[model samples]
Target chain A: MLEIKNLHVKLEDEDKVILRGVNLSIGPGEVHAIMGPNGSGKSTLSYVLAGRDGYAVTEGSATLEGEELLEMEPEARAAAGLFLAFQYPVEIPGVGNMTFLRTAVNAQKKSRGEPELSAAEFLKLVREKAKTLKIDADMLKRPVNVGFSGGEKKRNEILQMAMLEPRMCILDETDSGLDVDAMKLVADGVNALRDAGRSFLVITHYQRLLDHIKPDVVHIMAAGQIIRTGGPELALEVEANGYADILAEVN
Target chain B: MALAKLKDDALAARLAGLPASAASGWLAAAQTEARARLAAMGLPLRRDEYWRYTDPATLNAPEVPSAARFEAGDEAPAFDGIDRLKIVFVDGVFDPAASDDLALAGVEIERLALAGQADIHWAQGTYGVLEARGQTPVARPFAALGSALATEGVLIRVTGQATRPIALNYHHVSDTSDAILHHCVKLEAGANLTLLESGPGAARLTKVLEVDVGEGASFHHIRVQGRDHERRAATHVFAQVQAGARFKSFTLTANGRLTRNEAVIDLVGPNASAHLAGAAVGDGDFHHDDTVFVTHAAPECESRQVFKKVLMNGATGVFQGKILVKPGAQKTDGYQISQSLLLDEDSQFLAKPELEIYADDVKCSHGSTSGAIDETALFYLQSRGVPRAAAQGLLVLAFLAETIQEIADEAIAEDIRSRLEGWLQRHAAKGAT
Candidate 1:
């Protein structure tokens, strides 16, 4: 369950406004895809919800499970079950991928007052999850995202999402640099995690990814606001004819 | 010149307080030569090009500034887990009761005080030879001072592969002790040895370690400068590596008021390899400097210089490194990189990297960079549920990992890593976030 109402945001260092009073809500187990043209504030919405820096939420609120997400620190938001799959995953030269994942998992567990996983337990679980994403031992041993290809990076993000098991997941342009096969693999991983207690906000530019993991609903956004809301067919319409027809009609 | 007169006055004042040594025969001759050299060069001054980034006032002062001994608090001393021939020193004086027997299988070891009294010995040829050679391009008056005035040290001669490392453990007790020590190590042809040194010997310390790696021999040196925050030290490592020989040296420095570690390595034979690396973590009131010069004189030699520093809360770090490839030294591969991770705007890092190649076929590359923590990487880690401080600590360790990998021994590397982790945890509690 995720909710965003009248979400207005502006760059912290500049006066330029990005998201302007956008409203969206997703219920439990539901998958929603947001399609928008360039600079329409689709990615900004995800960043604002995930509590990223460089953005000032001028007005409105975004909540996860009735908890104010914007007011919490990024780590607290994560502990409270918010996950953001970045378009370009950061490449950390020194921190190994396995170490990063383990630290994150244990940190969340400790913050939640749950027992931390032993090294053996963690290794087993991560290996199982990685198997589905086709991430080998070497990938897990290497530094996070350092020298990783586009497809590998996206898949690594998916693996992290699976490991963290956040209640609400936001994928910001996860399909941008991935090939069709990689997209399908990532979609399968995401589909396996879909259940009654989990929700997804898939922000994409095309309908090709939606084809792999069918969405329950689709929203067409323009100029910082959601101009239209429909079913999966809305994504098909956008693919058939670009956003030009829809933007002109909405104006 | 006014600069020369100032240096002369400073050197004279500092030399007036030296503790007298009863030198004789060959040792007396060496000490006399070293004293002449010091008198000619004088102590370093702030205006000198060599001491540009770091001030030499405190190191040049006559009176030793008192340093409070650090209570490591339940942390095991460095290299305690390794099997080594322990030679202990307290306040720069050899502690025979605390040291092991002066005997090892493949090496001949003797104290400098005992060996200097002998009329003739193998160490007489190397006592200050490397130190004098290292003073040519740069005037290291502190090293000359140590060689001329030191009353205690160790002399080691290796003729075969050493079964275990030789550990020089320094324990600081007297707050006002001014310690000077000189050590010489000669590795015979085809021999191998590893030397380990640790601790803050005294309030104001000057140390010189000269090593000669003979043809086809190998020498490995690892040092962990003590954690006394108010201590000031000037340490020098002068090494000459022969043909087909190997030389590797690494140092880890934590908190100290002032620390200058200078390493001068000369590769004189073909196919010889040398590596010099250092990792330092400094907090407020800390100043750490690593000055290294490596020379390649023979064809097909390789040398690498890697140094990294982590500074926060107004701490300062300096690096001056140079690599020279002489004429006819074709196929020389030299690499140098110095980097700093400044945790805040108040901290500063200064670096100067130089490469001189007379042979056009040589490949020498050098890089120097100072940067803040990668914000994107930090945010990514935080997004995964790691707290801000823990994430930063991880990144800092990662930054130092490249330099730590230069160590040939895995156990020693692991020990160093744990020590760094302990340092990070202690500082993190002081609001590193």
Candidate 2:
């Protein structure tokens, strides 16, 4: 389970509050969609939850399965069954993708005191997961995210989330730069990883990705706060009209 | 003896007492000239600009007597399966019995002293000079010392269209338990040679190698300095490359108490190329210095210099590289990069890369960076269940892999990698215990 209680976060080195009085809760087997206009603090929520540096938590708390998430390091948060599918993955030159992914996975397992995987076993599992995501075998051998297309990088992020099999996954604008086919493929990868004991919080500005990944709850956020929560119809309503109507009502 | 008290007469007397077999007329004249120069210049002090980073006083003492003869009947130098002509020099004396006949179809591999009589033009033109255009006062002492005590060296000649590579193996072993100097190596026109020079004992040795690359010729020089723990060694390599010729030199210094490998390369002809690369790793109380000077004297010439140093424990390492472009050397492309990784806070590294250009149309750049291993990379590895030591070792290995990637020979590169791993393990264990 994941819980965000009146979370108030600000951009680093500034007094500008980005996420103000935000509250959300999602249980096992539930998919929550957070849709908002530009600068609505959608990506900031993901980063704050992932414990990235340079984000000041002005107030409130984030807890995952009763463990404090904001106080932990990014790597520590990752080891505690939390995964963030970055919108724009960083290109780490000279660090092989397979090497990077294996390190991350084994790091989580090591932190949990799980047995480490041998090279052969790791390769077998990685190849299987990569095949499901349609990533080429040679891509694993290259530097992380180096020379990858926009769509490929997004898909690679999803592939990593799947490989880690986190208990709670955050898909931040996974469909922003993708074409129709790429959007379908990415959504399908996320759908495949969904399970009864796992949760997903898919954040986007459009409803196109939701056509493939249906969510149980839809929340509309504006001015750093979630003002409306409804069933799946809320996504259709925002898609048909836009955020202006919702903004007028919230104001 | 105090270098100030070292008179020409005393030097000449010592030179005269040397075995006749190791003496040559040209060598005798060089010793006289060097002694005269040393007398005029005197020994360099710590205040000298060139010796600022390195103190020559540690090496200054009464000159030890030259060993009478090289200790013979030692184990042969290990080749690790690389096959080429082997020319052996033991204790500054040519070892004909240990040397192979190296009578390839069109190549000739012989001692420089013997070649002086067989082919006077090639030998004299190659080994005649001891001029290093930009050498400093600090280097003057060692250069003068090596020149004053010149002995046998290798002479390799490859005729036109020769396909085989000539390997020159120079090994120095101390039999008289004293220090000795071996000077000069000459490679002739159209010759393709791979010189593998190794010093494999606890004897104090000093050697100077001079190479002449004729027009359109190619030469690859691989020097591995592996001296004993107590031995103090110094190597000076001077190379002159002619039009359209290529000179590639790689030096690896892994063990020594006080070692300096200095290389001076002159691009004398248009379109000539020089590739100079070196890796030096020092542990414990060892001190290693690699100084390189590359001069672009002709238009359209290209030169690259890369040096990497890894120091552990209380060891110290220094890399000083300079790229000089002459006025008329237009369109010259020269690049130099020197990087150092200090494994611990106690280890120290000093890197200075300089570029001086007089040509208006030239692309010359030099950069020097020194830092510890990446902390993020370290944590990334350790988080993956790799023990702390193994993680650190892997990160360090990857850090040096950039330099190793430039090696032309994969097998040689792998061998160097294994040696580096072994070194890391030993040092890590020592640190652990």
Candidate 3:
């Protein structure tokens, strides 16, 4: 479903290198977890794959379903089935959450040559999705992420992931600010979308999130490179001990 | 103090070609006083503190610069969906043939041409009263010029809840026409009225709208400055609110060579509320300015000033707004926000937000910001499959949504939003820098 070959990235405006020759791959219906400490280039991988600005891919290629992803614009990449759930959801002051979601849904549909959903149809679908996520009408009506609590923001991100239904989803620190219940709720939302045709790359530092949404494989990343790979038990090992033991062993 | 030689020359030249007032009685007296005031203040100069960011050359020049009339191309005119008493003006001249009859329940509408001829009229005390009061602390010489020279307008008086809004439609027909209009509105106690104005009147337009809101009266004003890309206009609105009165005005300006809109509001009674908001979108050779002042003279009053603009391709926008809480006006609430979204590096926004509080217990806040589109937000939208251009258009509209939200009517607000969307779509084709 997704492939990264020797992905090398550096800051566009600085001389610092972020991702140094990182490589990863995930098959359809598989969920992979990448765990690392702060400043370990985990977020950079997600941003670079998402086509965010200010990052230069010095050497590497990323493909989604065998189609080159790095060369396409962000929107084109999205249409090609790549979604990044941001660690910190942006707070847009005046754009309503519902409007943003509807626009995104219709935009993707239009780009894929699919007939756009009517307003009524879209509303019904969004309401059903939001209901399971516990997002009420007021939350959907408010400006996107403006004054939203930490849990609400995370839930909103999951809501987007559900609406877009991208084949290759990158969850970058989606569990960072969520409470236990919110984590479970978000995990439920993600689990509901998991199928043979969809895959996820969940990036986090804690094993608690893995407890809710089990991963097929777990990789330990450090110093801009993936140094180790294991199963879901590796996350529990990291949480029980720490990244220090793994770093020491890997070195 | 003697006026500078350059200022004197410009003022003299501007006054030389102006038509003499053919009014009589109270109207003539008001015009006389306005002329004397204009002579003393003179037309604004580039050196003046208030005009520093804007050049007054074309506005002060003797000969009006010709502006080719714009064809709106089959777009339904603004306020077409509303049931209104339409009063049409072609090149600042009242077109009775195109206007609805000046008869409505609970309101009296009269043409300025006819109202000025009457020896005694209800508008007698309102014609220049608020303008004179607003001249203090700042000299709006252009408003004085409009008051003194304008010969076309409408006089509306509301004694009860108006059944529908009164629409003043200005049509531009001649490239060299210099149109001046002065309108006076008086709302008696407990009365309610909404005044809607639209269109680009002429190559050059100078207009003054003075409104007097009596005790418990409410007045709503919504205006759309026309889209003639080369037109030049200077408009002023001076309103006085009595006890328990309400005043709300919102304007949408798009695509003009130069436009200066000034609004002055005085809350002279307790529990009065005044709100002034505007949204402007311009591209290339376009300059729009909004200068507003609100005064809280009584206790427990509230005032809001919200202005937003979207500029690109070297277009320029300016905002100078002030809120003054006078002595003894306790528990006053004043809020002001002015922001601009510059689509390119070349576009510019200049803002001066001021707040003066004489009362000890007052809540006043003002903020001003000018910035490019939010790159992160843009990415967030684009990553959702919205095209880059469509994402930009959405963000621009979102940036201006705060000002549009100030409109009390949902249908009117929707119309305004659609118009803004149209502007964005048209400009998107031209490509943002």
- Where model 3 places Cα greater than 4 Å from the true spot, the runs are B1-4
Residue pairs in candidate 1 whose N, alpha carbon or C atoms collide under 3 angstroms: none
How close is each model in CA RMSD to the real structure? 1.2, 7.0, 1.7
lDDT by residue (tens digit), candidate 2, A1-251: 99999999998888888999999999988999999998989999998887665679989999999999999866677778888887777665556889778877787788788997889999999999899889998889987778999999998988888778889999999998899999998999999999999999999989988999999999999989999999999999998999889889878
What's chain A's TM-score in each predicted model? 0.99, 0.98, 0.99
In terms of lDDT, the best-performing candidate is 1
Alpha-carbon error at B115 in model 3, in Å? 1.6
lDDT tens digits, residue span B1-433, model 3: 3456677778889988887898887789889999999887888888888898889899998898989988888877898888899999999999999999999999999888887987888887888879988999999999999889889999999999999999999999999889999999999999999999999998999999999999999999999999999999999999999999999999999988999999999999999999999999999999999999999999999999999999999999999999999999999999999999998999999999989889999999999999999999999998888888998989999999888888888878888888889889888987773
Cα distance off (Å), candidate 3, residue B109: 0.4
lDDT of 2 by residue, B1-433 (tens): 4543543344444445444334545555555666566556665555655566776544554444232322323433334556666666655566789777757666665655654344234555444364433244235556666655555555556665445445455454553333344444444556565566665322456566777787888877766666355456667787888889898888777766777777888999999999898877777777888878888999999999888887777778888788889899999999898888787788888877878899999998888888887664554343333445655666666666666765666666666677677767766777631
Arranged by DockQ, best first? 1, 3, 2
Q: How do the candidates rank by lDDT, highest first?
A: 1, 3, 2
Segments of candidate 1 deviating more than 4 angstroms: none
Better of 2 and 3 by lDDT: 3
Give candidate 2's error at residue B215 in angstroms: 1.4
* Candidate 1 lDDT over residue span B1-433, tens digit each: 8888898999999989886667876777889889999989988998888899999999999999999999999999999999999999998999999999989998999998888887888877788899999998889999999999998999999999999999999889999889999999999999999999999999889999999999999999999999999999999999999999999999999999999999999999999999999999999999999999999999999999999999999999999999988999999999999999999999999999988889999889999999999888999999989988899999999999989999999999999999999999999999876
Chain B TM-score against the true chain B, candidate 2: 0.85
